[model samples]
Target: KWRGYGVATADFGRADVTWSTQFIGKATDFNADPGDLGYRTPNVFYHNVQFAYDLFEKTRLMVGIDNLFDRKPPFIQSWTDANTDTMTYDLLGRRYYASFRHLF
Candidate 1:
């Protein structure tokens, strides 16, 4: 697994921007060669971006999206059980969310 993050704050406004990325490697799952589906797994990378602005001295609004690239998980045969192994794949593609926070 790998991860990174970056943040930017402007002196003129109460605005903040941030970016982050992460990588998940394929699993080492193994079975007897005879039961192996002959499928290979590949590493996947996910990226996210976020923006926040202060609406008031004590209130801030933030918005962001995860899995910006919308990468799909590798496909595996049914014999392996699950179509795509959740152990090594992220089925959820690009998600967006917003939130507001108040500080005392």
Candidate 2:
């Protein structure tokens, strides 16, 4: 499988904003054991948006949300003991974060 990202950003006054999107192309694992889920998986996409503001000459604040689409993994009922292949799929739908940084 192959994964890639798309990003865009702009600056406005004291704040800089950004938008990023990630894509995971479809893949097939022919070597998977018979007890595993399916041999193939569908493509998936995720999005994230963030904003960073200058709080001080040396300090900055940033915030963002990931998995904006809240995408769920494909269903797999035939698997041995797994509801969904969390190892090869995304389980956490959406999440958020905040951070502060200061440079000396």
Candidate 3:
């Protein structure tokens, strides 16, 4: 199996934006026979984006979204939980997040 991540960021003074991608290559279920249904899973890509701004000299606020496209995980024959491979795929369709950071 192959996996990769890519990220791009742009900085504008006290603010910045970032975009990222997560890729999972197609995989075969060794436990399933070659002719069995659902023996293989298709590759998938997940997108994410974030925006950050400096709220103060020492504080920063950030907001981001995960699984921007609401990509669904591929099905695997050997794994029954959630009807997909949770370990190798994303189960959460999409999610949002916010964070604050301060330094002393």
Question: Of 1 and 3, which scores higher on lDDT?
Answer: 3
**Best to worst by lDDT, what's the order?**
3, 2, 1
How close is each model in CA RMSD to the real structure? 4.0, 3.6, 1.4
Tens digits of per-residue lDDT for model 1, 19-101: 77666766433532434653555676778888889999999999999888998876665436657776655678899999999
TM-score of each: 0.69, 0.73, 0.89
Q: Per-residue lDDT tens digits of candidate 3, residues 13-92?
A: 99999999999988888998997777888889999999999999999999999999999887778887777887777787
Candidate 3 clashing pairs, residues 3+ apart or interchain: none
- Candidate 2, which segments miss by more than 4 Å at Cα? 28-40, 76-88
lDDT of 2 by residue, 4-103 (tens): 9899999997899999988888866555654466566678888889999999998999999888889887655444555556676668889999999999
Better of 1 and 2 by lDDT: 2
Q: What is the C-alpha lDDT of each candidate?
A: 0.71, 0.80, 0.91
- Error (Å) of candidate 1 at residue 100 is 1.0
